[model samples]
Target: MSEHGFWSRFLLPGGLWLFLLFVVPICLVLALSFGYTDDLGRAVYAFRLDNYADAFDPLYIPVLLRSIGYALATAAICLLLGYPIAYYIARYGGRHKHLLIAMLVIPFFVNYLVRTYAWVALLADEGLLNSLLGDVGISEIQFVNTPYAVIGGLVYGYLVFMILPIYASLERMDGSLIEACQ
Candidate 1:
């Protein structure tokens, strides 16, 4: 391969994609972060910092803390959760690999709102969880429209956000890497 070879040429397309889609969107977000809705509810463009300034107000700060705390916990949980998953699949999933991945994808292929509503059914007061609890005489485990319910939904809803890339990376893994890790 020449010093000026195909890898150099390959970088151009990926760079263009990043510039057009990824970089542009982030720039737009940053621009909007310093921006706001005017009195007429139109988006006003300016470099003022009120968007962040408002984040420090008493009413918003508690919600912000809760969200940030949850996000950090979610990320740490996802990493702890996802790593073992990808590793286990890569090591021992065997012939059911495609089937397992298909199961994950199947929920994603279903209507998005349908899944959320299904969870709604599962989490409702007279729902399946409550009924199961009654059957087992575990009557005090609270669910439905609570913080735990929201976290459950959010975790299930976003597992796909962590799953696909994990599958892809594991699927394409070098056998030698597993042997080395072992």
Candidate 2:
């Protein structure tokens, strides 16, 4: 393609897409940040930093710290779990690579509520896991309504969120070295 052809066909269109979809919305949100909400909670556009100041209030410190802790923990766990799965799929998926990726992605098509409820059922006192344990003469273990349940749910719920990016990165990597490594 010629210089003009490349610029017009790709760069210009790509830049326009970025400006419209990403930049414009961010600029609008940035402008709105200096504004205030009305009594009925409608946004009132006005210049003020009061909202920004309130965001750093000492009362919110613990909440902020807790959020940071949760984010760090989630990231650590996701990295540990996602990297190997992604690597395996990318490096050795072979003829079934698309099938594997589709399987990983299919859960996103299901309703989030349905998945959560399924987890609840699986973890309930009289649920599948406990019942299986009981059948094996093991004591019924409480799995639901606890911190472990919450963390397990979080990990399960967001596992795909972690996996997809890692898979993408791995898939995009140069693969000639993979056979050499093997």
> What's the TM-score of every candidate structure?
0.75, 0.72
**Candidate 1 residue lDDT tens string, 1-182:** 88678687998899999899999999888888888888999877799987788889999989988888777776666677777776676668799877877776788888888999999888787889888988999784657767777777777777766867886787798988878999
lDDT of each: 0.80, 0.86
After TM-score superposition, the amount by which residue 145's alpha carbon in candidate 1 deviates from its true location, in angstroms, is 2.9
lDDT of 2: 0.86
Candidate topping TM-score: 1
Question: Total backbone clashes of model 2?
Answer: 0
Q: Please list the residue runs of candidate 1 whose C-alpha ends up more than 4 Å from where it truly belongs after superposition.
A: 1-24, 167-182
Where model 2 places Cα greater than 4 Å from the true spot, the runs are: 9-17, 124-147, 171-182
Over all chains combined, what TM-score does candidate 1 have?
A: 0.75
Model 1 collision count: 0
Candidate 2 structure quality by residue, lDDT tens digits, 72-126: 7777787899889998988899999999989988887988889889999998899
